[model samples]
Target: MKAIVIGGGVIGSSIAYRMSEAGADVTLVEARRIGGGTSSTSYAWVNACEKLTSRAYFELNWAGVKSHRRLAEEFEGSNWLHRPGVVQWQGAGAEAAGFDEGDFDKLERLKEWGYPAEKIDTQTLAELEPDVDLSTFNPEGAIYYPEDGWLDGPVYAGAMVAAARQRFGLKVVYGQVTELLTRNGAAVGVKLANGETIEADTVINSSGRWANEAVGNADHELPLAPTVGLIAYTVSGDTSLRHGLRTPLVNCRPDGAGRILLRANDIDKTLPFDTEAVPSNPAAQELLDRVTQLMPALKGVHVEAVRTAIRPIPADGYSAIGPHPALSNYYVTVTHSGVTMAAFIGEGVTDEIVHGKSVSEFAEFRLSRFF
Candidate 1:
């Protein structure tokens, strides 16, 4: 089968690689560089912890976590998936009240679901993350999930595309997709901004923030309530932080090298949803300040770069996968947790497209639900 995938972010790259591996002729089209979009700016936390909205969502994310392990085994020696685990604590300013009732309830729920979770006291926390300063916000304990990890999206995406090219002869086109060409109610191909038309038997829309634009004249609409996220990267410095950290003030993790990625939920709300540029200095500096408080070793570190990207969330805030409701040959795979779900969704979607086998787990996340 001939397949054309739009977007070169993590999702699109994964699908393209899997499809090519399945012996399908695949072409990947990217507007800019691979992973230059939302994938690059994402926190890239690979976990099922925050996916507490529903059991199905939770299971999907869990499968995603396992998929990362499989990918690591398959691609042995890749440094993209770092699974040192994550540690989270709860409290107010400069005072740790330990886990709140809500936090405890979530931990209990995770434990009941057979997820690896344990409460570690200050000493254990210190042992796990020796560089972190636990004096001011001395919490009784913190929750640790041994299975959680962080992904370097751009590195992974680039690796996948390179592997696909070397192993399966995947074709990659670098240009903006201007239209999704259709004939007789079936997707036929796509037209690039340079007026080049590449024909295909099937088209998969994995375009993150540009989903609607990729639809072109398909006579279907993808409802996306994308939100802007601001992430600040610190200058490479001396720091031994080994795990993803979630505290009351900031959420951070190692961003390869010696740089750390920092973000805060409260800071995200301060930015406008429609913003396309980097936020002001105050917002970027705030992330550095917050992380410095948590890790005093980063005291003299400066903000290296601040990236703002739109999170592609379906209207209801769940994944939308499967063939388009009205267009049989056009498929879509989009979600807010693209980093975590990319591998699983890529494998499952490939089975559905290449072998005509329906993925049972995708039943609740179909595009037809919204239509």
Candidate 2:
């Protein structure tokens, strides 16, 4: 079968790699550089802890975490998958952040669900993250998720595309997909902005925030409530921080090469959709201040890069996958946790397309619900 995948972010890259590995001729088209979209700016935290809205969604995310482990084993190394674990704590009064009663209840539920979690004291927390300053917050309510980690999205996506190219001859095209091509009520392929047409037996739209645009005149619409997020990358500095940190003030993790990634839920709301990097932007400066307060080792390390992108969330705030209700040959797999679910979605979609198997896990995420 010939398959055309729109978007070259982590989800699309994974699908392309899996489809090509399954012996399907696949062509992945990207408007910009691979992994340069939301994936590049994401925190890329791989965990199901925050997905307690529904059991199915939580299970899906859990599968994603496991899939990452399996992928690392398959690749014989985890250079792109950092499993240092994550340590999160909450503060009181004005310093309060996550880990409220609701969050703690969620942690208990996760533990009951067999997910790895432990409520650690201040001493244990210090031993786990020596570089972090724990004097400001009470660590009695802190939680540690031993299985959770972060992903270097760009690196992982690039590696998958490279593996697909070297092992299965996957073709990647760099151009804006102007529209989806349909004939006789079935998706036939895609049309590029340059008027080039590439035909295929199936078309999958994994275009992140651009899913609706990629659908174009197709008889299907993907409603996305995308949100803007900003992340700051710090200059390489001296810090012994190994685990992903979620304190009352900020969320941070190592970005490899001695650098660190910092972001805050509160800061994201203050940012505009078209925010540009102006060296001393208040939002970026606030991130620097928060991280410095947490890890004094980063005192002199300045913000090197500030990236802002829209998070691709379905209208209902859940994943939307499976074939289009009206367009049988057209499929879509877009969600908010693209980093965590990429591997699982890739394998599931490939099974449905190449081997003619129905993925039961995707039954709850079908696009037909919105129609």
Full-model lDDT for every candidate:
0.86, 0.86
Put down candidate 1 lDDT per residue, 97-131, tens digits, no spaces: 22344347767888888778888889998889888
Total backbone collisions for each predicted model? 0, 0
Residue pairs in clash, model 1? none
Summing lDDT over every window of 10 consecutive residues in candidate 2, give the lowest-scoring window: 93-102
lDDT of 1: 0.86
Per-candidate TM equals: 0.94, 0.95
On TM-score, the leading prediction is 2
Q: Name the TM-score of candidate 1.
A: 0.94
